[model samples]
Target: MTRAALVTGGNRGIGRAIAAGLVARGVKVTITARDRAEGAEAAEALGCDWALADLLESDSLRQFDGAPFDILVNNAGILPSGSLLDNPQGYFDCMAVMVDGPFRLTLALAPGMIARGYGRIVNLSSGWGAFAEGLGGPNGYGIAKAALNAQTLALSQELPGNVKINAMCPGWVRTRMGGPGANTSPEDAADTAIWLATLPADGPTGGFVRRRRRIDW
Candidate 1:
């Protein structure tokens, strides 16, 4: 049977590349973006589908109806600037997008995935989130990603045998957040996410991976 997949923040950059890769693999892909025009344009470019979803708002999440997706790539995120003392609102937005949205979306989709006895969930996490790696990003960014990693681990245990969940650090990719000086390309960073989204039943779960190799989280 053909697989259906959903990618968040897929209007551009790494998310867009992952969506394109999934579409190339014959998965029926749906991407979520806050802007309708941009989302539609990206969807058209990828030859996939698009939905309006803003991860920052609970109401926006409630409006999304993308269940029945066999694979889910929670790639939507933001890099909140400033230190802990400076960016309270940015911190809130970061947590909303990186942690709360994925948590709720996973809760919503996991049931269908469990019932179908098949699923792959990939959370785009960061090395900055890892305790072993010293939680290196901006104030809210690392904390949110750490929570996301925890979410991945927790869900992996709760999910059924055939279903798998994992977190991955896409590395420093040349995306809007990553900046022009970043070393990795969008397509290169997308590789691990695409791999995680299409993992076999036997693939490792509850793990943090970079370039498809397991890493400390």
Candidate 2:
């Protein structure tokens, strides 16, 4: 049987690349995006399934239909910009996406993953998740990601033995969120995500990795 996987925000950028990679590997892929048209187009291109769900809504997660996905990539996130002095709302939006969304989705899916006795969860974190240097564009974005890294470590320890959960700092990738001058491409970031999703049974967990090397939290 083919392994099943879901990639949120998979209509474009890093999420798109990761979904494509999983589909190419013969996994049954599902890509979720806020835009229905875009999500459908991406799913068609990748030859996979598609769904539209806004992370801010709890009902959005309930639509998963309880499928036992072998892998879940929580790549959906927003990077709203504002300085710490003037970004009050930005902080709330960041929390809704980077922190609350992932936490809820994982909780919703954990039982099925545990029951399967074989599962992989890859959370798309960032280099800023560890060290906070040079991340001044959006104070809320960096702060949310940093909290996500902590969640990854904490969640990993809570997972069952047969399931492997890890966080990945994909570095600064060239995407809408990464901006024009970013050095890396979505393809580069997707490599590590795909690697983590398809890890062997004995693979590492509760780890933060980039380019296959472990990084400090």
Candidate 3:
């Protein structure tokens, strides 16, 4: 059977690149975007399917609960809710977009994956989430990613032998959030994610990796 993949926030940036790479590999791809126009445009350009799903909304993922996807890339995120000192709304917003929604989506999809005896889950995490890096990103971004890392680890233990779940740090790239001066391009940042999403059954799980190599979590 042909493999299928769902890439969240795939209308642009690193998510977009991941979708493109998967399509090039002959995988059926469905990309989600909050905007219809953007999502449709991207799907047309990439020769794939598109869906209107907002990660911030609680029920946005219900529609995909029955889709048979061999790969899931949780690449959607937002940077908001300034300093932790303020205990602001954006902090919760960050968690909702980066952590909560992804977890819910995984829960909705993992069952089908297990029944099929094949699955690959890749969480797009960050160096900022690492204690070695001192949880450095602004706007609670670091905190949200750290929680995502924990989810990746916990899920790995429960997922079966044929299924693999891991987190990877897609290095800073020149995207909307990374700005123009960043050192990498979206496609370059997408390399590690593409690798993890297509790993062999024997590949590592419940680990944090960057540039295709294991890194401290």
Candidate 4:
């Protein structure tokens, strides 16, 4: 069967790699990014569909006219600089993408998957999200990701067991957000994501995973 997959922030970074991997597997992939040019170019390069969306805009996503997908990968996120105290507004900015957007999208799309008796959801999380690293302060990005992990677990339980849902901690990939000298490549980070996406109906759910090993959540 031809499976459909949607990946957010697919213009670049780990999201791009995950989308490419899915396309390589012959999945009909749709990638979403905020930038039209980048999103279009990436989609063209990968021979996939592209949708322009700023996940923060709930109405924008809600009003989006698109085909229902069998798989949804919430790979979009942002990292604003500065400490939590210095960047108070950063919390809202981060939550808009990481928490609010994924929550709404998952809620909107899940019923279809349940009705069909199969679905795959990959909610991208972070190692920092597992616990309070001294690195992650009250910053919006960190907190939102942590909260996102919780949401992933909660949502997984609500879905049919055949609809496998899991959170992915991609490690520290060498993206613009990860900065220079980051150890993991987008390709490496994407491995677990693609693996989770293509799982069998009896696969695990409500788990936090990296390389298939359950993480502390």
lDDT of each: 0.91, 0.86, 0.91, 0.86
Q: Could you tell me every candidate's TM-score relative to the true structure? A: 0.97, 0.95, 0.97, 0.94
Can you write out model 3's per-residue Cα lDDT over 1-217, one digit (the tens) per residue? 6899999999999999999999998889999999999999999999999999998897888898878889999999887745877767778888998899888889888999999999999999999999878888887899899999999999999999688999999988899988899998999999999999998878888999999998887
Report the Cα lDDT for residue 213, model 4.
Answer: 86
Number of backbone collisions per candidate, in order? 0, 0, 1, 1
Regions of model 4 farther than 4 Å from truth: 64-66, 132-138
The candidate, 2 or 3, that scores higher on TM-score is 3
lDDT of 4 by residue, 29-138 (tens): 98998888999899999899998899877777874333478899999998877776888778788899999898888877788787787799999998778783432634
In TM-score terms, candidate 1 sits at 0.97
Tens digit of lDDT per residue, candidate 2, span 22-135?
998999999999988999899999899998898877688787746678899999988876676787888888888889888888887778989878888899987776764444
Write the number of the candidate with greater TM-score, choosing between 1 and 2: 1
Model 3 lDDT, residue 119, Cα: 92
lDDT of 1 at 4: 95
What C-alpha RMSD separates each model from the true structure? Answer: 1.0, 1.6, 1.0, 1.7
